[model samples]
Target: MLIDIFHDTVCPWCRIGKKHLFDALAKWQEQEVHIRWHPFLLDDTVPAEGYEFRNFMQNRKGIKAEELQHLFDYTQREGEAAGVKLDFEKIRLAVNTKLAHQLIALAPTNIKNDVVEAIYRAYFEEGLNIGDINVIVAIGTAYQMNATELKLQLNDRDVVDAVVAESAFARLNGINSVPFFIMNNQVKVNGSHSVEVFLEALNSTALLDIPAKI
Candidate 1:
């Protein structure tokens, strides 16, 4: 089975969904499952320098202070339950994740999940600015990727365009949300579903002879 996950690095729910998917995989009897990561920019218009997290939420999303706090609190509780420790207060910047997605794209299929997990941990858990080239380089190096090559690729217009194109393809398919999962290109599951839900989908897809999408 091939699982293509359409998600953004900054999405807290995406992180949770990743954990749920992995948990399901751990219990799955099948050993031939392949997972692919696809980019979805939550805020594609964000500047390269990004914006202060609180200000962006308030000014752009029009979220008031109390309401924002409630939302963060709820998300943090859910994250903890999903084994993700997101430090909302420590996150100062809401970054543009195009570069991060490009870095993940550079990784081999086997290590792509590691790259994605590192990006999520740096942004949400450590509150690092993933949009910064230096920070992205450091994350790639820590994952044993070539730092100099990764830095050069990050600045390359072609690589950036590829990531943008992938996002466009996702939108063309009517995928407007993060954490969207497609199994074998025949079954689609959206949002941060439970581990049981993912397992059920995996099992069901294995048993069905659904025609592959064109």
Candidate 2:
């Protein structure tokens, strides 16, 4: 079965959701699973250089410093429960994910999933600016991808267009959230759902035998 996952690299929730879904899959030994990761930009308007993290979050969420801390604390605790680490303080900027998405889109099939996971870690854990070409090239290099080639491809107008277009298509289809999942192109699951929810979806007949019409 094919599991289409729409996500953004900077989204900590997507990391948690991925962990939970994979945990569920570990327990489910029934069918072969193929995961296809797609891009969903959290804020495409973020400039190429990006914004200061704290200030941007404060303005974006309309909260004061203490309130921002509260939000971060809550998210951190949730991440802990899901076995994912979120180092918000280490993040200096809230960057546009366009360049990162391009890298993922052009990655070799065998290493594409790994590239996505590493990009998430780079942003949420290491707090690197994924929007920067140098940062992306470093990550790609770890996966044995040719750095010079990867850099060129990431800047390729065609590749950038495809990556951004995928995000646009998701919005047009009414999917405005990240970490959204489509099981066998039949069952649609949204948000950072629980392992149980994922398991149930995996077992459902709609995804197994009777696929619902798209």
Stretches of candidate 2 off by over 4 Å are 205-207, 210-214
Tens digits of lDDT, candidate 2, 85-148? 8988889999999999888887888999899889989998999999899999999999998988
Question: What value does the lDDT take at residue 8 in candidate 2?
Answer: 91
Assess candidate 2 and give its lDDT. Answer: 0.88
Overall lDDT per candidate, in order of appearance: 0.89, 0.88
Which candidate wins on TM-score? 1
> What residue pairs are clashing in model 1?
none
**Highest lDDT, which number?**
1
List TM-scores for all candidates, in order.
Answer: 0.95, 0.95
Measured over all alpha carbons after superposition, the RMSD of each candidate to the real structure, in angstroms, is: 1.7, 2.0
Across residues 1-214, which tens digit of lDDT does each residue of candidate 1 receive? Answer: 7888999999999999999999999999674777889999888899989898997988876879988989999999999998988889989998899989999998877788998999999999899999998988898888788988888888899999999999999999899998999998988889998999999999889888554442
Native-to-model Cα distance after best TM-score fit, residue 132 in candidate 2, in Å:
0.9
